[model samples]
Target: MAVQIKICGIREDRALEAVIEAKADFGGFIFHQSSPRNLTISEASRLTALAEDRIQRVGLMVNPNDDFLCELAAHASLDAVQLQGSESPERVGQIRELLGVRAWKAIAVASREDILRAEAYADTADFILFDAKTPPGALPGGMGLRFDWNLLKGLDVGLPWGLAGGLNADNVAEAIRLTRTPLVDVCSGTEAAPGIKDVDKIAAFCKAAREA
Candidate 1:
């Protein structure tokens, strides 16, 4: 199967164009206020509309309440939601029920035990996203830090899963080669600066993912 690619933190027209041109499987929109890449629902709606039927549109939120998720669905045309914070498995189920969209839980991996902990989400989340753990005072994700790819070798996961954290065109092939992740997510790794996505990086990253 071709490796699915989720190009995250995308907020501009050129980035969206690159995502489509590179044949990415998913185009992500951030809704977390704390993140530089965050987009208001109205802003996301416009971009999400561009991705309609072309690629799966994913909305990213961090520890959001029900009302926030409700607003997201009401404003944005999304196919999936990525709960990239400390949300529980039950909450993922609740969000899926609330939005009628596929729900993905972001599991922060710093150790094997963290991977073991993510199993609890398998029953609720439509997919599990393995992202690098953030620093104590840092935002939830998009820090550009990478975990040990070897830590994922032979991981059971017990659910459909994807790899994230510190992935760029240069190292994405190594990541996919090592973990064989069916899907891969990238954000800062494809950026010219925080919140600024580089079209060339986006193109190269997608090219590497598909070739890998």
Candidate 2:
């Protein structure tokens, strides 16, 4: 099967339009205020309403509380929640128990050890999103940095996993070929500027990922 394509960091109606036109599998909304791609609940709600069943709406949060997650889920019209923070496995369980929504936990991987961390969350999360570990004080994600894909070779866990960070149209095929990741996600890879997604780049990334 072809790789599942996800175009993340969508902040506008046009960006959402671009992802849909490109047949992306998932469209991400950053709920963290620290990131430039961050979207308010009102803004995300407007865009979420425009989302169809063809694409999954993923709400991205960083170290969020129960109340915030509840409000975000209610407003964003999300199909899944991506926990991109330091949330513990117990917290992950709590989020799932409380909201009862599909949950994806992002694990920053810089080495094989990082990939092994998926074990703790495998049963708790519906999916595991593997992203590059950024420098201290850097952005939470969408930093366009990459780690070693070979580290994921022969790796197996209970939950499904997706690849992210520094992946563009050109290298996504190689990354997929190396890891054979079932799902691939891109943000800076498809953007001309931070928080500004280019339509052509979006199309190119999707096409390349599909071809890969």
Backbone clash pairs for candidate 1 read none
lDDT at 104 for candidate 1? 93
Off by over 4 Å in 1: none
For each candidate in the order shown, give its overall lDDT on alpha carbons: 0.91, 0.89
Count clashes in each candidate, considering only residues at least 3 apart in sequence or on different chains: 0, 0
| Clashing residue pairs, backbone N/CA/C < 3 A, model 2 | none
Residue ranges of candidate 2 with Cα displaced over 4 Å: none
Q: How much is the lDDT of residue 183 in candidate 2?
A: 95
Provide the global lDDT of candidate 2 against the true structure: 0.89
- Model 1, 89-174: lDDT tens digits are 88889989999999999999999999888889878898989999988879889989999999899878789999999999999999
Per-residue alpha-carbon lDDT of model 2 for 1-212, expressed as tens digits? 88999899998888899899999999998988889999988998898889957589888888889788778767668888889999888888788777777889999989898899999997688999999999999877999999899988997978899999899989999999999999999999999899999999999999999998
